[model samples]
Target: NLLHEPVTIASVLSVPTVKENLEYVIHSSASDRLKIDGIGFIGARKVHLYFDPPLVKEVAYEDMSAYPLTENQIILRRRHGYTWRELLGPLKVIGVDTGAGAVKVNGEDGVVVAQVMANINVALSTANTQLANNNKSHSAPAPGASVPAGVGGAGSDFLNDLAEKKKTV
Candidate 1:
């Protein structure tokens, strides 16, 4: 399954703007990849999302038709990173190295329901978890630090949370 393979950053792209020119280049690249590998690169497409009452708006509007979400997104001139936490879902996949000319079955096999072999890394979730844990530990007070009697002080709560996380981790 996908969980079996080591996750790594597969590729990176720099887009100065979400204008039509950039979108055209992205589409052309996907088409080229499809022609060469017989596998479509759906992750290469980009969408321009425009909304009215642009800031602090309750609703959003899209100018494009329904389409699959991109692997990632970048704002025109804002932060360089784009992450989607709500769309996150666990995956189970297995990769076959066709170069070996032999197959190894780890488990049951059936007709493929859906598959995508884009240039993407699956480690984003794990990496994010590690980072969050690190931040929590760094902010936590020492284990033996004194805590107030009446209320659960931040130190005790932090240590308790840390211990719980350690057990789960």
Candidate 2:
């Protein structure tokens, strides 16, 4: 069964806006071939798939069919009529391989995901450090320090209530 090991499908898309894009990793064991005609989010209307990479096949939403060819491979078909430049990024030579002197196209989803996660981790760490510093800087006042009037002083009503509750406990 394919359940014994899971396969990964990685892809990259160039959209008009990054806010509309969703990043996800799905795990499924169903053998039935499934097709995705559109993708939508809650409160957002579904958008038609305009173009897919590599195969660039044009298929109607009604007739589109997709299934995993192997454990790791699935065919990609584009929505009809979208320009190649709109689906993929602008056709510019990004790099040249000096060793083989050949051009190669590779998907960057894995690298993009890794970089995003690293950025999130760094942000979380920075926020936690700032919170800890704030907490340390605003510690309780010294025993003889003057607490303002109506504040929680030694004879404050709040402290008296707590003392009364502690006696009953």
Candidate 3:
């Protein structure tokens, strides 16, 4: 589920990661695989997120119609909460040759490529502004495993505010 927000940092925690052998996870049904600690995106692109403590638990059948994973991939899942800084430790577009600036091919100026990257950086740096906070309520109707550790840092503050907002009559 594309939680009105993105989850980062939690993957870097000291907890060990659990990996899924592709041989075991591939399935004819899309939703069925989602039950097994899978991370999904639009168009049924399924990715395997690291399970905390390096353990893969057998999950019950869930209405994972929400997440449609296409190809199988792996990523470190969030194990703990995070701060604004940690959420965006250091954003960089890899493969950029700093010495030569943007990359170009076959006698083409890299103006367009550079511009696109600049815009992406802007969107990321001010992500809160660029993306709408569709988080209408404190309770995330998201279908999946609950965060291993409760939110902390700035995220904790925001979640607390949302909880308060939810409590207000």
Candidate 4:
């Protein structure tokens, strides 16, 4: 089961802009992973996310999809870092290490559902939470605090909805 294994960031791509030519690089952790779509490396950067150092995330899942056979989505349970309350969901699953190969149960087998999340949605949701917290915390952010996307007044309604959904989870 994926939940049995430790899921951590494998690689991070700093995409300064969409126009920038991105070179394909395979992250070592899931280098041998396989899928019907194609090799994982081509879209590797898009899948992996970057988190600040020392900030470990807590993972949570809402439901499992039976047909596709995976968890509905990854939920951020808690944040671990210097200023965590300011952060949103701790879990953001990038890629599954299918290359690691699966262990078999000699006697019987059971279905295992894995969690999944899109790179954009997870990021926007987290940013939405961060922005909301920023409003409550220090009236003025520390000098040069990096501004995440959706900074224009609490982001879009979808973002607000995402923030609300996160709270319920």
Candidate 5:
């Protein structure tokens, strides 16, 4: 039950050999974790660009057939949504130290490891929390409570059901 919308943005690569650009991008899935490199442009929205980056070998699950794969090889499924910046605004970048510059490690010289970009969209930011604005209108059902197709009830109903079920067991 996830929805994905198309988006775009500008991004730079960590690699010195590559050039960066602004391009249209499509966002999908639950977690919204996508390979910045796998994205492409859509239309006049050239300003909408995908952030591509190099990949390193890490264990991950490649498919559903292997449910609950090892951590190193696990690819957790994600809900689709737009990145935070797309929904909110340009995110401020921070500085980071990777110990060695691109040149020092790859033979170039004097490079810095910039802060990792975090997609803090409206759906992800703390601002969207259920406790934030008190979103009681679309509140989720409690555990063990069978909610009718479109019925509303107090949250206690769910907990009551769970208590009854526990007693029977």
Candidate 6:
């Protein structure tokens, strides 16, 4: 079963794209008849898959109807009120440059490509830093402490006072 299998960070980083990583996970695991509840790509490299219980014998790649493989890429099924067609437009395209170890997303503006593992690491680090900062800012303050003033606070206070006066009149 995937839950029992050892999927290290290094193993996850080796795959170039989210799709490929997910495929690798499904292929490598002992369980054959697995149902994927959900999947997500965090940063660029991290691929998360949610599965239901009662693991059954292994199912072949062809037998998995949900994942349809094409010559170049795997077209994901639309789910959770979000479709790849809607987000990436009708011509949703992702290209993998194996030589460069990069994955490119074709966008309206231009194609964006980055070194897969390295880019994901950087993005994850940045996200961690931002989260840390947010947590620190939201930590409980000392007793009798006043909340720090933020941008537009005075303007909002003035508007609220004006509304209160109007209500009184």
Top of the candidates by lDDT: 6
> How high is the lDDT of residue 24 in model 2?
28
Candidates 2 and 6 compared by TM-score, better number: 6
* Model 5, total clashes: 27
Clashes of each: 3, 1, 7, 3, 27, 3
Off by over 4 Å in 5: 1-29, 34-93, 96-153, 162-169
* lDDT of candidates 1 onward, in order: 0.28, 0.29, 0.28, 0.29, 0.29, 0.30
| Candidate 2: regions farther than 4 A off | 1-69, 72-103, 106-115, 119-121, 135-169
Best by TM-score: 5
Deviating ranges (above 4 Å) for candidate 3: 1-150
Q: What TM-score would each prediction reach against the true structure?
A: 0.16, 0.17, 0.16, 0.17, 0.19, 0.18
Of 3 and 5, the candidate ahead on lDDT is 5
Whole-model lDDT for model 3 versus the true structure?
0.28
Candidate 3: give the clashing pairs: 44-68, 44-69, 44-70, 45-69, 45-70, 46-69, 46-70
At residue 146, give the lDDT of candidate 5: 52
Q: Measured by TM-score, how close is model 5 to the native structure?
A: 0.19
Model 3: what TM-score?
A: 0.16
Model 6: residues >4 Å from true position, as ranges?
1-73, 85-89, 97-100, 105-169
Worst 10 residues of 4 by lDDT: 13-22
lDDT of 5 at 95: 18
Q: Model 1 off-target regions past 4 Å? A: 1-7, 20-60, 66-169
